[model samples]
Structure formats: structure tokens, C-alpha cells
Target: MPITLTIPDGLLSPTAQAEAFAALTEAVLEVSGLNGNAFMTSNVVGSINVLPREHVLVAGKPAQAAFVELKLPEIALATPEAKRTFIEKATDVVERAAGGRLQRDHIWSNIVYAPDGAWGIAGRSYDNGDLISAITGSAA
Candidate 1:
């Protein structure tokens, strides 16, 4: 799993940007119920891109909007309810990190899933069962 956050530069103070990233990561793990899983935690990683304001768009026009995107295999965050929770929590994280600089409407979050077996890490491919096994420590 990978969580990517994109925020327009200057939308949040420099320090807030860092906090926002951490919060976003936590939100994903928390929603997926994998906070204490070492392998899951280590492999679920991504980046925060603070781009120039002109680089971000809302409805095809430039705006001070933030985007949170999570990419995972179909089996991860597989339920509608799970994805909804992650979105809500992620949106909240963006709001708090913005310190009111941005409103709820300015934040957009999405979860996208690759087909089973499309996800891999460190040169090893993993199918749905492989991923679940790795996550549960039930297989090597």
C-alpha cells in the first residue's frame, strides 16, 4: 500500500506540511487496522508533494486544493466502509494540518486498487493471498 498526499505549496506552514504527511500515513494505517504490524507499516509508504500552486487544479481550474490518494491491492482497504473511514479521517488530517488555511471543500481523497497480484515490493510480487499471509505473519 502507498499513500500519496499532494498539497499546494504555501497552503500550510512548512512545519505543518510535515505534520500533515505523518498524519496522513497514520490515518491509512489506522483505518486499515495495521498499526502494530511491522511488515505492513514498513511496506506501506509514499510521499508528500508540495507543488507550486499553479500545479494543482480543482475541477480543471487552479485552486488551493489538497489531494490524498491511496494505492493498494484489491484486498487492502477492500470495503466501502473502510475506504470511507480512511477518506474522512484523511480529510480531517488535512484540515487540521492546514490550520484552517483550507476548508473541507478544498480537500479531496481517493482510494484506488490495483487488480490482485498487481502489487509488489522489493522486487517480489504478491498476490492477494501472499499479501494477506505476509501481513498476518502466517507465511514467509
Candidate 2:
């Protein structure tokens, strides 16, 4: 029951991305009732995508978009109800981070549970260095 949350491109700035990352982490803790340290200790991974040439017009103005995709273990999906619960909770976190400018439609997500633990990590690394810098707060 691994869930992946994909953020839209250019939706967040560097500072905003950092804040969103922290906010998302907090949201997960609140919804899952998991300890912060323990949750951080887990192998949760995230990637951010920035489309420099990508912009959307809102109120006749151009705005940048950013995409963030997160992958978590399927252990959260023990039952159908659990899967629904996770999706609902996870999407809530994402929506909050997006500040109403983004929604489920703006992003794409996938949840897969496999006994052999096959979630393509390398395949999902399409964000280049922008997202990595946002996640790590280092120079890209």
C-alpha cells in the first residue's frame, strides 16, 4: 500500500517548497498519529519537479508551478478501508500544502502494494536537481 503524491510543476518556490515539505511531514504525523522521529527514520522518499517554462494564468497573470511526488511503504494499506483512509489523509496534506491553488486534478498519484517490494525508485526520479535542492536545501 505505497502511495505516491505528484505535485504540479512550478507550483512552489524554494522557500515554499521547504515549508511545504515540513508541513507535509507534520500533516502525516498528525493524520497517522506517528512519532516525528520514527516517521523520519522510515524510508519515506520524495522528489520535486520544476517546469521553468511551465506557467498557468490565474487572473491574467502567470504563475509558476512545482511538483512533488512522495512514496511511502505499502504497510499503510492493510485493508480497503485503510487504503481509502490513507489516500484521503494524504491528499488532505497535499491540498493544504498547495494553499488552494492545486488539487487532486493538478497532480497524479499511484498506490501499489507488492509482496516483493517493487516500487521503481529510479523511474520516479524525473525532477532533476531542482526538487533535490528543495528537499535538501542545498545548491542545485
Candidate 3:
């Protein structure tokens, strides 16, 4: 899984940006119940893009906004409840990190599931079963 975070450069202090990234990672793993799974933990990766104010847009107008997008295989956050939990928690993590600098309404989050076998890491593609086996350290 990869969690991408995009925020206006000034929206968060350097310390907050680092805090948010770490919190966001934990939220994803915790919500998906993969917190301690080696494969899942190692694969949970992404970039934090701190764009210029003018480059950040909301409703076609430049604004202070943040977006957290998660791309993962089907089995990750597989349930509606799980996805909802992640959205709520992820948004909270970002907002809190901003130290009230960002409006809750300005934060957006979404989980996008890849088709089975379409997710990859280190040049190896993984399907639902492949992930399960790796996470559990067992043959499927």
C-alpha cells in the first residue's frame, strides 16, 4: 500500500509534516489490521508533496488544502467499515498535525484499490493471495 499526501507548503510546519506522515502510516496499518505484519509494514510507502500555495487547488481556486490518497490491493481495508475508519482517522491525523492551521473541511481522503495482481513492490507483483501469504508468513 502507498499513502500519498499532498499539502500546501505552508499549511504545516516541518515538524508537523513529519508527524503527520508517521501518524498517517500508523493509521493505515492499524485500520487495516496489518500493524505488525512485516510485509504490509514494509510495503506501506508513499511521498509527501508539499506544493506551493498557488499550485494547490480546491474547487478550481487556489486554496490551502490537503489530500491523503491510498493505493492498495483489494484485500487492504477490504471492508466498508475499514475504509470508513481509515478515512476518518487519516483526516484527523492530518488536521491535528496542522495544529489548527488547516480546516477539517479542507482535508480529503480516499482509498483506491488496485485490481488483483496489479499491486507491486520491488519488481514483484502481488495478488490478494500473495499478500495474505506474505503477511502471514505461510503458504497459501
Candidate 4:
């Protein structure tokens, strides 16, 4: 199944967006047992949001806040093990990116596993469905 991973705002620095994407691509490849070539071809999409004048009560005073959000299409891997492994690695990358600079409580995410038929195709005829089935099973 393709697993969609959603990363909430404030989990990473806007400047580090590229780095974060690279990290995710690397992590997914590592867990999926795929080479750098395969990882590079994977369809990866991301977005960032900046809230202006967001206020929060701090020590009985209002404070401004900012954050970023990321979304990854549930990439199909070679197996279920690979899927789980990728998720673990991805989570680690997210946590490391967040570090202690952002409030952990503000971080939000969701993983949605869908059937292979539901997986979207992107790029020039490059789809991970076959690879994902090889690892996760036909249902994926």
C-alpha cells in the first residue's frame, strides 16, 4: 500500500526544506532497500506555510508564532518491512529536524495507507507501484 506521510508546521526550518526533502528521500531509500537512483526518481512533493501575527499566551503575555508543513505521497516500496522501516526512519528525520527549537506539542502528522490502484502516478511514466508491491504485498 502507498503510505502518505503528513508533517505538521514548525517541525523544520523553512531554510532547511531542501535538506528535509533530501533526508526523507534518503531515509525512504535506506528502509526500502532501494538504491539512490530509485530514490531520486520517487515522486516527492512538499509545501510550507507561514502564519503571520499568530498569537500565543506566554507568561501572561501574547507571543508570535510561525510554522511549516510538509506532505509526502504514500510511496510504494518493495515490501511491508520496507514500508515500516521507511516510516521509522522518516519519523526520526522529522524529530531530529524539529530538535528542541520547536514545541513538540505543535507537531502533527498522519500516515494513510492506500491500495495500489489509489496511488497517484507522477513524472514521466515512473511509478513505484510495482516496487511497493514487491515489498508490501498485492493489496498495496
Candidate 5:
């Protein structure tokens, strides 16, 4: 899984940005019930893109916004409740990180599911079964 956190420059302080990224990663693992899992923790990687303010937009106009995007296999966060929890928790992380400098509505979150066999790591393709087995340390 990868969590991409995109924000307009200056929306969050340097320290806050780093904290937000860490929190976002934790939110995913925590909600997915994978916290402390070595493989998942190490593989839950992504970037924090602090783009120019003008580059971020809302309805064709520039806006101070934050975007949280999670890319994972379909089998992850498989339940509706899990998805909901992640979204809510992610938005909360961004909001708290902003220290009231940004609006709640401006912080958006979404999840994109990779098709089976399309997810890969370490140059090896991993299907749903492979991922499940790797995560659980047992046959899927």
C-alpha cells in the first residue's frame, strides 16, 4: 500500500508535514489492522508533494487544499467500514496537522484499488493470494 499526501506549499509547517505523513501511514495500517506488521509497515510507503499554491485548484481556481490518495490491492480495506474509517481518520490527520489553518472541506481523501496481479514489489508481481499470504505469514 502507498499513501500519497499532496498539499499546497505553506499549508503546513515543515514539522507538521512530516508528522502528517507519518500519521497518514499509521492511519492506514491501524485501520487495516496491520499496525506493527513488519512487511506492511515497511511497504506502506509514499511521498509528500508540497506543490506551489497555484498548482492546487478547487473548481478551476487556486485553493489551499490537501489530497490523500491510497493505492492498494482490492483485497485491502475490503470492508465498507474499513474504507470509511480510513477516510475519516486520514482527513482528521490532515486537519489536525494544519493547526486550524485549513478547512476541513478542503482536505480530500480517496482510495484506488489495483487489479489483481497488477500490484508488485521488489520487481516481483504479487496477486491477491500472494499478498494475503505475505501479510499473514501463511498460505492464503
Candidate 6:
């Protein structure tokens, strides 16, 4: 899975930005019941894009904002409750990182699911079964 955290420059201090990204990662793993899973931990990768303030927009106008997007296989965060929990936790991570510089409403989050057999790693495509086996360290 990959989590992309896009934010306006200066929305968070450098240290806070790093911490928030780590926190967001932890939130997703924990909510998905994969916390402490070495395979999942290593696979949970992401990027933090800090763009110019003018590039970040809301209502078509430049604004202070953050976007957290998680791209994963359909098998992850499959439950409604898990989705809700992640959204909530992700929002909190950004809010806390802002240190009163940003608002919850200004932070947005979304999850995009890759179709079965489409998710890939190391140049090889992985279906849902392949992912499960890899995550569990067992044969599919």
C-alpha cells in the first residue's frame, strides 16, 4: 500500500510533517489489524508532497489544506468500520501536526482500491490471493 500525503508548504514544520506521516502510516496499519506485522510494515510505503501554498486549493481558491490518499489492494481496509476509523485517525494526525495552524475541515482523505490482479511489487503483479499469502507468510 502507498499513502500519499499532500500538503501546502509551511502547513507543518519539517519535524511535524515527518511525524505526521509516520503517524498516518501507523493509523492505517492499526485500523486494518495489521499492526506489528513485519511484512505489512515494510510494505506500507508513501510519499509526502509539500507543494507551494498557491498550489493547494479549496473551492477553486488557494487555501491551506492537506490531502491524504491511500492506494491499496481491495483486500485491505475492506470493512466500513475500518474505513471510517482510518479517515478519522488520518484527519487527527494532520490536525495534531498542524499545531493549530490548520483545521480538520481543511484536511481531506480518500482511499483508492486497486483491482484484483492489478496490485504489484518488484515488477510482478499481485492478485488478492498473492497479497494475502505474502502478508501472512504462507502459501496462497
Give me the candidate number with maximum lDDT: 5
What does the lDDT read for residue 70 in candidate 5?
A: 99
Looking at model 3, report the run of 10 residues with the lowest lDDT sum.
Answer: 131-140
**For residues 19-119, could you state the per-residue lDDT of candidate 5 as single tens digits?**
99999999998998888887788899999999999999999999988999999999999899999999999999999999998999999999999999999
- For model 2, the stretches where C-alpha displacement exceeds 4 angstroms are 1-5, 26-33, 36-40, 52-74, 117-140
Which candidate would rank higher by TM-score, 2 or 3? 3
The lowest-lDDT stretch of 10 consecutive residues in candidate 6 is 131-140
Model 2 TM-score, 2 decimals: 0.50
Model 5, C-alpha of 21: deviation from truth (Å): 0.7
Candidate 6 lDDT, tens digit per residue, 29-92? 8998888887788889999999999999999999999999999899999899999999999999
Evaluate all candidate structures by whole-model CA lDDT and list the values in order: 0.87, 0.46, 0.88, 0.46, 0.92, 0.92
List TM-score per model, in order: 0.93, 0.50, 0.95, 0.50, 0.96, 0.96
Error of 4 at 98 (Å): 2.2
lDDT of 4 at 95: 57
* Candidate 2 C-alpha error for residue 132, in Å: 30
Question: What's model 6's lDDT at 136?
Answer: 88
- lDDT, model 6, position 27: 95
What is the per-residue lDDT of model 3 for residues 44-105, given as tens digits with 9 covering 90 to 100? 88999999899999999999899999998887788889989999999999989888888999
lDDT for residue 54 in candidate 2, whole number 0-100: 32
Better of 1 and 3 by TM-score: 3
Q: Which structure is stronger by lDDT: 4 or 6? A: 6
Name every residue pair that clashes in candidate 6.
none
Model 5 clash tally, residue pairs: 0
